[model samples]
Target: MKFGGLQLLLAIALALAAGVLGAIAAGELRDTGQSQTLHHFVHEELDLTDRQKAQLNQLENNFAAERKDMEISLRAANSQLAAAMEDEHEYGPKVVSAIDEVHDRMGDLQKATVRHVFDMRALLDPQQQLRFDRQVASSLTSEPGE
Candidate 1:
């Protein structure tokens, strides 16, 4: 099937934008305190009490260390995949292994993130829990770079 020039150009532009956004997000996540940001949002947006805020902060701090370790593993896995790609030997097996490692690390990170959110919500009252649920739903629908 033949493709139109504009369609192909549009596809390429979209792919480029996705790559740029991914890189920017990775840098921000690596250098910034995302765990702190999560607590800040819950404190400011959920009208949490001082004690609840402290509890949330403590929870986030605990999760932050684990999350950071998972991120390191993910980065190392990605580096291994890149090395495998650039190696003189056949890349198929090495690349597959690295990708699987990345997936496992990512799964751990995602589990921690969800657990963090749940633990934070548990500290809130019923009203706050409802509001927090709505907040999470809206946040999920937010645009990139939010």
Candidate 2:
């Protein structure tokens, strides 16, 4: 039997969810020393002194830790909302309010991430800062057309 539009959308969502779980299971999404983006950016882009590298690395670690905690809390909130929705009688104003709260926290987490990036930028010397800005601009401009 041919699937209707809603059924097709549901199937697509299921597939996407399965793909995400599979990636996590395969260790592709695991945190690793080599997978730290800020560290990689500094190593590849900046000519930092040993002391500078150490300080930057510490900052990167702190940012990653805080971001991870925020992500975990967000996931917990989403799961709570989903569980609430599954209860037909209980899915009311409370569920809607919970979802809104989670959305607000997600927005705050994103803004915090941006602020952390700026903190990283502040760690650079004037010459390195100029180079960093140029590198970021070039990377964005090099992206394929929309």
The TM-score leader among the candidates is 1
The digit string of per-residue lDDT tens for model 1 on 35-139 reads 334455687777778898788778878987877777777666666655554442333787578657766766666777787789888999999889888777765
Pairs with backbone N, CA or C atoms under 3 Å apart (clashes), candidate 1? none
Candidate 1: lDDT of 37? Answer: 49
Clashing pairs in 2: none
RMSD of 1: 8.5
Listed per candidate, the RMSD to the true structure in angstroms reads 8.5, 7.5
Query: lDDT, candidate 1, residue 76?
Result: 69
The TM-score between candidate 1 and the true structure equals 0.69
Global CA lDDT computed for model 2: 0.61
The local distance difference test score of each candidate is 0.64, 0.61
| lDDT (Cα, tens digit) per residue for candidate 2, span 1-146 | 44467655554454345345433432235344332344466787687889888887898799779877776766666655554444323448756765666666566676776677678778888998887777656543443321
Q: For model 2, where is the 10-residue window of minimal lDDT?
A: 26-35
